[model samples]
Target chain A: MKDNNRLLSRMFKYKECYLLVAPFYIIFSIFVIAPIAIAIFFGFTDFNMLEPPEFIGLSNYLTLFFEDDVFLVAVRNTLIFAVITGPVSYFSCLLFAWLINELPRGLRSVMTFVFYAPSMSGMLYVIWAYIFSGDMYGLLNQILMSFGFVKDPVQWLTNTETMLGCIIIVQIWMSLGTSFLAFIAGLQNVDRSLYEAGAVDGIRNRIQELVYITLPSMGPQLLFSAVMQISAAFSVSSVCMTLAGFPSTDNAALTVATHAYDFGMIRFEMGYACAVTTVLFIAMMAVNKWIQKIISKYADV
Target chain B: MKFKRSKTGPARSTAGDTAVFMILIIVGLFMLLPFVYAIIQSLKPTEEIFAYPPKFFVRNPTFDNYKTLSQLVDSLWIPFGRYFINSAVVTVVGTGANLLFSSMAAFAFAKYNFPGNKWMFSLVVAALLFSGTVTALPQYIIMSGLGLINTLYSLIIPAAATPLGLFLMKNFMVQIPDTVIEAATIDGAGILKIYYRVCMPLVKPAALTLVIFSFQGLWNSTGGSYIYEEAWKLLPTVLNDVASAGIARVGSASAASVLMMLPPCALFIFTQSRIVETMAFSGIKG
Candidate 1:
């Protein structure tokens, strides 16, 4: 009885603090946590929105690996997208941010604004349709024809061979987004004195200073950007959907996200979608762990 | 190691500086091309927009598209004014709530020595890795269950408690000096009072950064799932509709796209330097 009373008092003592944080917890739990839980549960069921979910063990997973040809293609494409864009974007963000950090303040801001604008602006990328338009009038075609490099317009977004490549190009362009901003901030946050100290401590140049001092100091920002890149890389359907049609011809540009969107929202196969999501979740977790391992090496140095 | 560090900044010669400037300009133009294209296209007359050899620069620029948009606003069977109001209300209210809630939670995590605080903070961080695609279907189910479908609140309320906002706030707040809080407490002010009057004002830059982020997010979000009702639909969805209506509306669609892009661009331009400063200072200070 005495212990129970003490516990009650302890809870009461922190009630205001809990109250301050309650809104986020309440909303996040209902909106985010609850949904995630539901998704996981639905992964084990045969649910098609109209009927109650009937439990089906491992069939969805089995189908995904063994029977779903389109899913296999999606898996391949998603991996390609993730593998190519992930490191390219991460390294570019770091390099550009590092370079921009060395500039004078006003010029640095202008350059940052220019690079950052594409990612932040809404659907401004729709202009790529014109640039890559399949006609004599298209910019790329006109440029190529002007140089006599090609007599005809090459279909950029429509042709199966080039659509994924086109999307990847756009993806790389937008990839220097939030993570780039984070890197800029992270680079600025690195102690100026440390570089001087390192210079005194036999650090030769900028490269050596970066290797010895900067990476170790900005560990948190590095981790944050890695996570951002991973999430952004994995969930790249919107760009594909906008640039290439949803089920791009031959499923050439199909990402796991677009595939899941097809099943979940369009076809109302919530169970199958959840199963697909589960697979992505597992893959992403593995990739995130790998990324941490890679980045932590630099953090430690 | 023979190389020496530059005292002024990272060491560079005139040639190296010029090379750096050249690279940055090339990259900047690559980044700026789409926006530049879109803006010029939005202003171009319809003939110039789809001309045989597509002109990079607008030959005959006009406000005809904007005029067409304004006159045809009511033809879509939904008042254009309602879309504007709905977009404003949702973005402003949603962003305000997001900042307040995230900051309050962040303050609690940063300042208070409460039970389960570490676990909760870890949860927020973990939540950051989970994408919206994983939760979209279930989110729809939850929204419909709560009868929030087809309402602006559906958008506003769910987006109010994002993990990123909470993480950013917590990261910033951890750097704030505790002595000020102690002083406030000693003067008989409560946690809420200290948070509102003392800490909140101190973290205004971080808050403004959050505002820019949240406004852009909410502004660009589509109500395709939540609200199909024309009255409650936001700007992105309407802009999408205008853009997809057909080739005839493409000119006006470009104008609409430019219009949609303006507020966020303006906000970003205004807040960019401050955001950079605040973000740069937070991690190391913390």
Candidate 2:
């Protein structure tokens, strides 16, 4: 059609721009976009690594929903993890960033480093494993015993009751990362004249100033941090695998992410794993869209 | 440099200031405790490491764990230096590729009014929703299909086009005034010259922040499922293996973590201010 021809001509006219962006799009198509397409396709098929995918016509999904008990548990655990960690971490990141923003520059940078250190350190969360080591010499166990809070070492990692809690704690501890920094930057960029105007406009306390001026100004950062936190909360895997062994005590910490890893990597059930991840992908997209809509509405207001 | 906002804004009461200081200190300590514990554990003598009712402070600090770590490295089947080299090469190359590709693409997205410009950039943003977990299985399939399995390119190439880098760079680039670019074009500068000579210098903070992010990610990456050969394993993988040996290697494990943490932390310290400055401009709103 004429529209298609015109679009093609426009593309040709801006070929240099296309050429400049080609490297990213090419790699992105291969690694990111292609994988999502393939994953969706593979979700409806039966394939292990060694075999060609056979069309299975929604059986994978049916089995995932009705037949797989572990999948249900994984979904439930993932939801709980996301619900608790997402909001808590987001608020904490905002609160901490706002507080740190008030400090003198020298002290502020040091405080930022202290909070952000745990996140940047590679595999240093393993230190948490030792702290929660379920042994007499473990830091937490020793402190509890000395204080007479518990009679004996608690199996924090191995116990189904406490495993998820330990993971959540560690996640929150490390959660003050990019989003936190974003909040700090966002706070710094808030117009100072507005604060002065608000003071003159009878904003008597810091809390009033924060609500009237700071929070509204920080809408974009709040959205960014929300998205980051939600994604991070849903994709909790490596820490779970490290602290509580894979398929933790009775799948206490078996999030959807680790479930997919279990099937795809460990059991070679690629089709089933793809189906599981497709569900996660859909859930994440829906939630992300919903949140973005809400935040953008609020921000516009 | 000085925090002038506090002086300009509503006056803080003594009680509120004290409470704020108290809460920050408590939270800061909580955030820092594990790291302090790890360093202390790493320094403790072997006997003290395993001593019942673990102490917070190391009484008899020593470097024996570090010595053991070096010895353990020396005994690895693959030379420890090979793993370090692999990690260094991956981090440097991956970060460089990411910066170059992302900045170019960002420049195009920000400055060009080409067909599919809006659509393609939105796709880049949408891709951020799909974390690595969602794509891991299919990416593995793609990697094998492309014969990237067990190769460094598998790690580097996929990482080079991350959405975060592109998002950050594009947002930064959009702030560059159009009149400046127009002036450059009028002065007989080509698009590439404008990008390189004019825009790149102006967006140095964003570029530096992108480098920090890419470097931290690549440095910490254990090559995941893509890498299998011991010779191609990164430093983290080697350190992890040592750490998982047993409780007897606890000292060295802690020592390994401390060593692993140093580079990123050091990089962060040097570039902290620039990173914050960059993030200020990264507001996602149009």
Candidate 3:
């Protein structure tokens, strides 16, 4: 009875904090959390938005893995996209941040603005459509024809061999976004005195300072950057859908998110789409956990 | 607040630095050329745009595309001003509500010792991993069930609680020394007063960062898919329809793209230096 009373009083003391934070929690629960729960529930059923959901045990998962060949292709493409783009973008952001940190303030700001421009522009990727327009008027074709390289203008988007490669190039071009900015912020936060002290403690050059002192000090931001990059790399659907047609030729640029979008929106098969996205959600969480483990190893250096 | 000062003194430039400078110049050009080309394309006459050996620079630039855009707007069944109003209302209300709610939640997490705080924070992290594609369908269902489909609430409510915005807010709040809050409390300030007067001013940089982020996001979003009514569509969706009318409207489409790109680009340019400076101080003080 005494312990219960103490607990009640403690809660009363912090009631205002609970009240202050309640609005966001309530909104998040409805919009984000509840939808996540509903999506996971739908994964176990077969529903097409017209009729009621019918529970089908594990058939949706079975169909995703065994029956659907395109689904497998999407899985493969998604993994490939994430594996290539994730690490490359991550390290390049660090590299660029390091280099930019050495410049004066005015130049640094300009360089930062330039690198971040592609992301801020609304219809930036439409230029890529013009460049690879599969005609003599296209930029690449004009250049190739001018040099007497190829007899014909190549169908870049329609050609299965080049579609995935082209998408990756554009993805990389626009990939220096949130994580890049975060890295810049993190690099700036490293204590100025630590470098001077490290130099006194036998740190010889910039390389040693980077590996030993700088990285360890920015532990929180590094972890934050890793999580952001991993999430962005896995969710490469909109860019793919916009650049190439939804499925693309021969499913070359089909990602799991795009596949799910096809099933869910276009086909109205919400259940199957739920299954596909659930798998993707799990994959992202596992990757995030792995990143945390890796980052923690370097965090204490 | 200038958190971006270089640690080491100006060192002698090396060959490696020269190589990096060259690479930056090339990369910068590659990045900005697309927008430049798009602007040039928007200004070109129809024949010039489709002309053989597609000219890199427009020979005769004109505001004919903008004139055509106004003509298209004149022909539309719905007034174009409605789209502008919808976007403006959504951006302002959504971004404002998001900043308020997120900062409030962040303060509780950062400054207050409360039950379930750790678990709640972990849930926010988990939410960060979720892709919107996963929630798109069910969210539509929920919005409709709540009768929020046609109303602007569907867009505004969802924008009010992004996990990333809250996470960043909480992180910045955590760096606000505990003694400051304690002093405020001992001075007879209530929780809300302390948050507004003491905490908010201190984290102005993070708040501005959230301002740019939330504003851009809300500005770019189209009306929810359930909102298919002609009167409810936002500017991006309207611009998309105009862009897809056919190849003949390509000039108008480019004009629309250029116009749509202006606000966010201008906002970013105006706030970017400050954002960097603000974010620089957002560093997790060890």
Candidate 4:
């Protein structure tokens, strides 16, 4: 009670500051926080859109784990997708940004555009659909045929064998987005004098300089990029849905987000979807925490 | 500080420079191929688009696909312009409100040592892990509760409070020298005055970066679950309908995508440098 009084008094002292932040917190609570709370609450219930939620403790989770084969496939696919794309995308963003940072300003901007444009153009990723389209008219098929690589037009999107691979390619294509930009800026902000000092300290190669100076200086950006890439990799759905149909060829490209989307939107199984999403939320937070620890450890070194 | 193009210590050998250039060019071309293909496809005549042994270059380019798109738009149940208007209102209002609110909140977090400041900022950061897909269903419930369902506000309100804007703005604002704020306070300026008159100007690059991000996001938004009314649908939703019609509408689909891409690309081109500038201060060290 005494602590509460002190806190309240402190808040009153910073009343103007509270007023400034109130709008964001209010809207954030209503939209983000409240919904998350409600979703967790509704996760236990078996609510269709029409009826009020019926409280059923742990049954939904039991069904999800024991009965749902499709959900299991989704979890498997999501893990695979995140594992491959997360590190690949993060490193590539760093590498490309570093390379681009070496160019003359005019060429640098153009290259940045070339890399960043795919991610920015909303739904333009469908162009990849055209390129990888399953017909003779598809660009890849045509090229392959002409080059005598394959006589048959490969069904890239429809084939279960190749569907996930195609989605990964497109995901990487779009992944050099916010993180890439942040890295370039971070590289720019790195103190150049450190490099000259490192040279004097017998840092002979560019790689050595990068390790001793650039990486440490970019500690924050690296962390930010890792978080962005990890979260994005985990929540891969819309691109999967667009390129390959939802519930694509034997659910080959199914992911956690798409699974939630399937139950929530298509099937109207609101409670099941909430449960799926809640699990996803927990998984993402866990991975985020782990990655943060690793990155901060490396940064400190 | 001006950004110098080259490092002084290591004189890069020509062989190394050539290797770097070669790799950059190859990767750059790979990154650019789909976009180039889309533009070419959009321009190709009907026969060229579906030609056997599909060619990389268009033999005869035409505006016919764009014409077809315009006709398709005109034939929609609601006026085609209504979707554009809806998108514009959502983007402008959403972006404006988000910038204002986020910057205000950012100012408090950065400048004031208020109680709960660290806790509140951490909450904002934590919210980043919750993707839109996870929250869509619950957001719909909240929207329906507030009677914002089927309204543009359903899209706008949620977007206006996104965590990215607040995150970016606060990071940028933290870089401003504390003495500047002290000077403003000494001049009898209030908190609001210092925020707008002093701090906002200093963070223009960050504000511009936020504007670009917010604008692009809101502009591309399809008003997913919360909006059901055809009249309230954004442009992308309507254009997506046109694009998904079938193989017959392929030309129009490519044209629709190119049209969708133009505004954001144009905006990025103009402000690319400013975005890079703003991102310099965006690092989040623990």
Best by TM-score: 3
Error of 3 at B171 (Å): 3.8
| Each candidate's clash count | 0, 0, 0, 0
lDDT of 4 by residue, B1-286 (tens): 4444353446345566567678999999998888888899999988888788788998888999999999999899999989999999999999999999999999999899999999998788777766666466677768888999999998888888878888777765765668888988999998888999988867665676677778888888888877788989999999989877988888998898889888888887877776555534442221
DockQ of each: 0.43, 0.48, 0.48, 0.45
Candidate 1 similarity to native, TM-score? 0.88
Which CAPRI quality tier does the interface of model 3 achieve?
acceptable
- lDDT per residue as tens, model 3, A1-301: 9998987888799999898889999999998999999999999999998999999989999999989999889989999999988998889888887877666677887887777777776457868978877877888788887889988998887788888778887887787877676666556556666876786788765677788888887666677778778888887898888878876988899999999999988998889999998888899999998888988888841
Cα lDDT for residue B5, candidate 2: 50
Two-way TM-score contest, 1 vs 4, winner: 4
**Measured by C-alpha RMSD in angstroms, how accurate is candidate 4?**
3.5
Considering only chain B, report the TM-score of each candidate against the true chain B. Answer: 0.83, 0.85, 0.86, 0.86
In order, what lDDT does every prediction score? 0.80, 0.83, 0.81, 0.83
Those runs of model 4 whose alpha carbons end farther than 4 Å from true positions after fitting are: A191-205, B7-15, B74-79, B110-113, B171-206, B228-231, B275-286
CA error at residue A251 for candidate 4, angstroms: 2.4
Interface-residue RMSD per candidate?
A: 3.8, 3.9, 3.2, 3.8
Q: Regarding DockQ, does 1 or 2 come out ahead?
A: 2
Residues A152-210, model 2: lDDT tens digits: 89999999999999999999888888788767656665655677678788988888878
Q: Candidate 3: where are CA atoms >4 Å away?
A: A1-10, A188-206, B1-20, B111-113, B174-203, B276-286
Query: Which should have the higher DockQ, number 3 or number 4?
Result: 3
What TM-score does chain A of each model score against the native chain A?
0.91, 0.92, 0.92, 0.93
Q: Which ten residues in a row have the lowest lDDT in candidate 3 chain B?
A: B3-12
